[model samples]
Target: MSTPVQLYIYDLSNGLAGQLSLMLTGRQIDGIWHTSIVVFGKEIFYGQGIMITQPGKSHHGSPLRIVDMGETAIDEDTFNEYLSAMREQYTADKYHPLEFNCNSFTNDCMGFLTGGSIPPYVTSLPSDFLSTSFGQALQPQIDALFTGRPPSGAPARITPSAATPDPALAASILQSVTAQATMGGPGPSNGILSMPPAPPVAPAPVPPAPSLPAPDASLVSPMHITTNPASFHNLLSSHRAVVAFFTSATCAPCRMIEPVFGELAKSKSKPDGGVGFAQIDLSVGLGGALAAEYQVHVTPTFLFFLDGSKTHELKGVNAPELRTQVDLLIYEAFPPHAHMSLSLSALEAIPLDPILFSQIPNLDTMFTKLAGFIDGVTAWNGAVTQAQVKQTLTRTVLPFLKASTATSPAQPPMASFDHWPTLTSSLIANLQLSELFPLVDIWRIALLNASFSAWNATKKVQEGPLNRFMDKALQAGDVPRNYLLTVLRMLANAFSNQVLAREVILFTRERVTKLLVDALLHDDVTVKNAAASLGFNIAAYLQKQRIDKVKARDDSQSAEENEEWETEIIVAILNAVERETNSEVTVHRLVACLGLLLRLSPYTAQVTSLLEALDAQRVLKGKLEKGGCREGGVGKKDVRRLILEVADKLCPDMAMAM
Candidate 1:
C-alpha cells in the first residue's frame, strides 16, 4: 500500500560505471539511458513520453532497482490526468540525450506524483557528467546520434491530445524536485547510481495500460514550472495574473497546500481565464534571484501579479487567503467595465478591443500601406478601389468594435488608447472622400471600443473631413449611400464620447441624426438601413445622457426638457421604422434598433406616439402573431419575443391592451 509508485531505469551503451567518473566533465557526459514512472494500480498506465516499458520488457533487462515514491491520496482519475499532461509537456521531440532525457521524465513525474524526488545520481548524473571534460568532448557525437533517428530505445513522437492540456494546474501527483536529486527518505541514502544495466539478462514484463479517467471539465488544469529560471518571465503573457509559489525543501506547510494551490490554479486559468500559476523550488539552482527579488524569505510564499507586476503577496498555507487574493487578482486582470444600470453583461456587450499590433505579423506593413493610400495625391477610382478599401478597413477595424466601450481594467490595445492620436490624425489629414468612406466604418468601430480621452484625441481632425464629406453629400442630387452610411455610423460611435457627441450634435444644429432619419425615405434600401442604424446609436447615446442627467437631478426644468428631447428622438426613430417597414434591406436592423430604444426607456409619450403615429400595433402585432421577426421563420432565435419584451418594458399599459 505504501509503495504506490515504481521507477524503471534502462542503461544504454554498456555500464555507465566504466567511464562515468574517469571523463566526468563536458563533451564526455552524454550518457545513454532511459527511465519510466509507473503508478501501481489494478492496471499500470504505460508511460512512453519516453517509451514506458516494464522492468525486463525492454532490450535492457530488469531496472537496476525500483524506487517507491510512497502512498498518494490522489484518486485514479486525477493521477491519470497528471500523467496525460506530462505526456504533453515531455514529448519525444523534446528529448535530449545529455540534457532532458528519460531520467528527467522520471524525476519530474515522481516529484509531481508523490512530492518525493528521484535519487540524485539519476536526475543529476547527466548534468554532472555533462559538465565534465569527457562529457564536453563526446557531446557532439552523442547529439548527432540522438537527433537523427531516436535510438531504438527512445519513445516515438506522441500525438498531442485535442483537448488543451492544463499546464498551470496539477492533479493528484505531488512533485518535489531539489537542486540535488536527494529526496529525504529512508531508501537510497547515498545514491542508486548504476552502471549500464547488466547486459540484458532478460526482458522485464510489460505492464497493462491504465483505465484512465475522462478529462477534467475545468477551464484550465494545474501547472508545473520545470523550465529554467531565465525563461520563467516569458511563460506568462501580459494582461494576465500569475501566482508564484516559492517553497523550500524544508517547508511542511508548502507540501500541504500544494494540492490546493494546484486546484485553485485550474479554476483561474480556464478559457477566457486570466490567471497563471508557477511553483518554484528554492533548493534548485538560480532560485535565489527570483526569491531575493520578491524577498521570498518564507516557504509557501504566494506572490500575485497583474500583467507581470507583483500586486499582492500572501505567505504560509492559508488556503482561504490565497483563494481570495487569486480571485481579486483575476478580477484585476479582466475587470468589468464601468456601466450604468443599463450596461450590457459579458455575454451581451460588444467587444471593442483594438486589433493589436503584436497579434498581426504584418501589422506595420498594413499600417504603412493604409497610410500611403490615404496620403496619395491621386483620387481613387470609386468603383475600382472601394471594395479593396472596404476590405482593408474591415480587417483593421472590426477587431476594435464591441457591443460596448470599456473603460477599465485597462489592458492591451483597448487600454492603450494613447497610441490612437497619431494614427487617427494621419487618416484625417490624408484620406480623401473616396477612401475615407470605407475608413469610416472602422473608425466607428474604433469609437465603439475607445475610452472618452482616446476618442477625444482625434475629434478635431475628424471634424474637417466629416464636414467636407457631409457638405459634398448635401450638394448631390443622387446621394452616395456609402457617404450617408459613413456619416450615420460615425455619429453612432461618437456617442461613446459624450462631449464629442454633443459637439457633433451641436455642430450642425443637431442635423446629423435628423439627416440620417430623413434619409430613411431614401430610394436606396441600403441608405435607409444605414439611417436606421445611425438613428439607433445616436438616440441610445443621447437618451442615456438625458437620463443620467435627470438621475443626478441638477434641475427639474432641464429634466423635463430631457424627457421631451428623448421622446422627440424616439418619435423620429419610430417614424423612420414606419416609413422603412417596406424596405427589406434594413427592416431587421431597424426592428433591433427599436428594441434598443425601448431598452433605453425613452419617455412614455414617445412609445405611445410611436404606436399611434405609425399604426405600429397592427404591423407589430401581426409580426408577433406569426411567431418571429424574420420571414419564413428561418431565424435561429426568437427576435419577435425580444422586440415584444423591449416594447412591454417601454409601455406596459399599451402592451397589455394590445
Candidate 2:
C-alpha cells in the first residue's frame, strides 16, 4: 500500500496588524512568521518541537499551503519512531531561533523518509533573518531568549502565556507551546488513547490492585527529595533535561498527584530512559531558599529543563498536563537519527569549490615579486609588514583582475608563474611580524588562484616556497593562532592540485601530514577548525593521486614503498578523525576524504592489506551514530552515508565488525 504524506503550513504573520508595523520607520512585520511540512497524511507540526494533531486547527489558520509529498517509507513503526525522535530534538531548550527550528526539523523528516528536501526559500529564513537590519538589532534578544538568557529589546516583554506576540519576538517564540494547542495528555511519551514505551524502573516489591487510587511502587521510579539548595541547584543544571517537582507535605493536591506522577515516570523507556523525576519539599529546612529562588507559592509544580536551562513550568495536579510535557521531555532526551542511504554516491553534493575567489589585478606583480625571492628569501632584505602586501594587492593585483573580468567575462585572469612559491624573502619578512593577519589572508587568496602548471614543465623544477616556510613555522614561538590558521588554509589550498600535492608529500617526507594533524589538536578553535578543513584537502588530493598511481604501477617489486606512503596518509586521516574534538563538519569532511581514499579500485589490494590491521568502523561509527542523521552543516548525512557506503565496499566480509 502506498502511504500518503501531507504538509501543513502556518503563517506566523496571521494576527499581526500590518498597518501599524508599516507605519513604523523600521520593521514592517516581526519576522518571517510561518512554519510547516505535512508528512504521513497527519499534519506533522514542529514549532516548539515536533508534534502531531488532528487537522481541525492550526495556530495561524489551517495551513495556508499544503503539498502532497507523494508516499512515505513510513511504516506505522517508522512513523512513531520519527515522531518520538522528533519530539526529543524539538524541545524548547534545543530550539534555536535560526539554527535549528521547525523549518529545519521538517526538512530533516522529508530528507529522511522521502530522500527529499524542504524548499530552499523556506529553509533560508534564518540566513535571511540574519541579513536584515532589524534582524541584526533584534538578534541578541532572540539569541538570548532561545539560549536561556534574558531577552534584551522587544523580546523582553514576551512571556510563556502572552495572548498576542510581537512580530519578531513571535519568531523567537516559534518553539513556544501552549496548553490549548496541546491539551491534557498522560504526558509526551504516552497518550490518553495510545500506549507508551515500557518503563525501565525495577519492579516494586508490592503490586497494587487495578482499583487502587495510586500506582504500585513498582510501576514508577522512586522519587528523591532535595535537602540542599546549592547542591540541588547544581544537580538540576547538570543534566541535559530534567523534571523537577515541587510539593509540600501538608498539601492535599501534592499527595493526590504523587501516585500519578509515579505512573508518569514509569511511562519513560527511551534508550537513556525517561525524564528524571525529583521533588523539592517546601516544608523542609532549606525550603525557604529553594522556594525563594524559584518562587514556589503553590504545591505540585513541575519544571522542564533541557541542556541546563529551565524552559517551561506548570503548577497543578493535572495528570494529562504532566504526561504531555513528559512526552516533550522524552523527545528532547533522545533525538532521532536521519539514516543516510548511499546506494552509490550522495543524493546531494556540494560543488567542489562553492566559494569563488574575487578578482585581483595586481596578481601578476605579486607573483613576480614572490617568485623573485623564492631562491634566497632568508638572505634578502626588505620591509616586511601587512601594509606592503595590502598596498601591492590593492594597487596592482585586484584592479587588473577586475578590469579583465569587466573586459571579458569568458576569460577571468589567472595567476601565471614559472614556479609557485608559498613564501618569499619579502613574504617571510612580513610574516615574521607576528601580528600580520591581513597580509596572511591576502597571501592565502593569491595562492588559491595560482597556476603551478604555468611553470616550465620540461625542467620539472621540484622546489617551491614551502621549502623555506617549513623552517620558519617550525621554529616560531606561540603567536596569534590565526597566523598558523592562515598558513594551514594556504597549504590546504596547495593540496588542491595532485602535482603540487605529490611534490609536497615527497619533499616533507610526510612531515606536512604530521603538521596538519598537530594543528587539528591546536588549543584555539579557529586553528582546530582550519586544520580539519586542511585534512579534507589533503585527503582529496591523495585520493586523486592514488587514482593516478594505480594506472602507472604494474610491478610487484615496488609494493613496499607504495604501501608505506599510502598507509601513512590513511593512518594520519584516521588518527585526525579519532582525535577530532571540535567542529562536527571537520569530522564529516575527514570521513568523506577517507571514504574517497578507501574506495576499492583496480589496484587497492596491495595497500588495502596495510589498512586491515586498523578497525575502520569503530573510530567512525561512534561519530556517525552520535550525529544521528542531522542534515546541513557540511552535509553531515551525506558524508556519513558515503563513509558507510565506501566502508562496505572496502570490507565486504567484515560486516559483523563494522
Candidate 3:
C-alpha cells in the first residue's frame, strides 16, 4: 500500500527575517525556510540529527506552509531501513545550516522515498543569502559554527560518508512513487551543519505589511514660477486650488511671509490634486499684466482660486489666517468621509502598508520557463525573442533588484527601461494563460521598485502591460490557481506606487473587485490568503483617501465607485470569515480588511445595514471561537480587538439587545 508523504515548511526566525532582511542583509527575503518530511504518521527532520515527532508538534511549532510530495510506494519496512542508514549519515555533529541542513536532508529523503525534490526557492535560499554583502561579511561566523569542534562541552563532530545510494534502485522507486516528481539530485552529501536557534514567537510567515511613506513636501518646488501672463493662466487652470501670492521684491512684509507661503505649498499641495502656489513678483516680467487682470492692488496680497476662479483674498502677512484658509479650501475641495469622526483606535493602529511577495525565486529557472513559453509562440522567432527577454532580465532587472534589496543609504541608479513594458506586454498578449505565471511573477517582483511602478503607471490604460495582464488573467473564465495567485500578488504590490494604486482603484475597480471577492471564497487556503491580501490593499487605499480627506480629481466618480463596491466587498469578507477554519493569517487579513472598509466609509448607514442583515457579529464571534486563529486553544488578542471594533461599528446595539 502507498503511504502519503508531506513536506512541512517552517520559518526559523518566525517572521523577523522578512521584516528585517532588507535592513540587515540588503535583500527582501521573506523567510528563512526549514523543511521536514512527514510520512506513515510520523514527522522526520534533521536538526540535532534525524529527530521524529508528531506533525506540526515539533519544537519548530506549526508549519508556515505544507506541500504534498505525493505518496511513496516503498513499504514501511523498506522506509525504516532507509531511515536507519540516514541516521548514521545525518548525525548531530554533521549539521551545518547552509552547506548541509534540514532542507538538504528532506531533499534527500524525498528523493529516496518518493523520487521528488523540494521547491527550488527553498533549496536555493542559502546561495541567494550569501550573494549579499552583509551575508558575505557573516561568512567567518558561519565557518566558526561549522568547524570540527561542537559547542563547548558537546561531543566532537562526526564526519558524514560521501557514499552513493544505488542508482538503479532510485530509478525503480521513482516508478513506484507517483509520477509528479520533476527534478533530480542526490541527498545527504557530506557537509557541515549546525542546529537552529529556538524558534521566536511565531507571527505571520511573510514580511510585515509595509507602511506607506508620508507625503514629502520636498517632492515639488514651493511655488510655481510665473514668468509670463500665459504661464500664470496655465497654472490657474491646471490646479484644483491655487493660492497666488501677489508680492513685490521691494516689500519687506512680502519677504517675511514668503517662507510661510512656501511651507503651505509643501504641506497642503500634494495630498489630493494639490493647492497650486504661484509667486507674482509684480516687479518682474509680466507680473503687472497678471496683477491688473486679477485686480490685485496691494503687495503681499493672497488670492485663492477654486476651479480656476478666485474665491478668497487676504492682505499682509497674516500667517495664521493663511493656514486656516488653506485648510478650509482643502476641506471644501475634497470633503472628508463621514465615519472619520468616530473613535476607532484599534483600526487606526493597523498599518496601511502594502503586503508584498518579496522572496527572490530562482531567477535562472524562472527565465528558462518564460523562454520556453516564448519559444512556443508561432508569431515570433523563438531564439531572437528569448535573447531579448534574457538580455533585459540579466543585464538590468536582476542586478537592479539585487542592489535595491541592499541596506544601502541611497537608492541605486535605475537603468533605462524603455524596452521593458513593451516586451512584457507583448508576452502577455501572446502567451497562453497557463504559461503566463512566470512572466507575471517577474513583473510582480519588479513592481516593488517605486520607480518601475511609476513608469508603468504612466502608460495609457489601453497600452499598460499590467492592465493587459490583469485583463487576461481575471477575465479568463477559469484561471489556474497559481496564475491567479501571482496576479493577486501583483495587484497588492501595485500599491507601492500611488499612481499605480490610483489606476487600480479608479480605473480597474470593477474587475479587480470581482477577482478579489471570488478569490476570497476560493477553496484553497493559499488562494484565499492571496485574495485577502489584495482585498487589504484595496481597503487600505480607500481608507487612506478618506483619512487624508483627499479625493480624485473627479470626486463624483471616485465616491460613486466606493459606494458601489462597499457592500459587495464587506459581504465577501463576512462570508470568508464564516467559512475560514484553517488559517489564522487569512482570518486576520480578512478582519483587517473588514475594519478598513467599515471605518471612514462614506456609506456608513448602508454598510451598517448590510452587516446587520448578514449577521456579521455572529459570523465574527463564531470565527473567534474557531481553532486556527487560536493558538493553544485561545483567541489571538489582536484578532479579537479588530473584530470588536468592526462589530461595534456595524451593529452597535447587538451587545445591548443580546
Ranked candidates (lDDT, high to low): 3, 2, 1
Backbone clashes per model, in order?
42, 33, 10
TM-score sort, best first: 3, 2, 1
lDDT of 1 at 290: 63
| Poorly placed runs, candidate 2 (over 4 Å) | 1-423, 430-433, 450-463, 495-498, 545-562, 600-613, 627-635, 651-658
Q: How well does each candidate superpose onto the true structure, as a TM-score?
A: 0.33, 0.36, 0.47
Q: What is candidate 1's CA lDDT for residue 328?
A: 75
lDDT per residue (tens digit) for residues 375-468 in model 1:
4746543332534443544443433442233334223444444434444444545565555554555455455544632555455633554454
Best by TM-score: 3
Worst lDDT run of 10 residues, candidate 3, spans 176-185
Mind giving the per-residue lDDT tens digits that candidate 2 earns over 1-658?
5576665655454444243334321445433434555544455555444555455244345565677766765476756654564454355444554545666556556654565555555655554544444344444444554445333211222222122224434433332322122222234433222222112222122221122122212212323344335435544543456777787767899888888775665455211223456566665534445777877778888887776677889898888888788777655554321111123454124234321223343555644444443433344445544445445555555553444445453455544543124224456564343444444445456544434322322223235455445444455576556557766766665554545555655566455666676676676766766766666665555444443454333323322134555566677677766666456766766666666555523336654555555666666665565443233322356666766655565533344634
Error of 1 at 108 (Å): 84
Prediction 3 TM-score vs. true: 0.47
**Would you give me the overall lDDT of model 3?**
0.69
Query: C-alpha displacement of 424 in model 3, angstroms?
Result: 1.4
Work out candidate 3's RMSD over C-alphas.
39.6
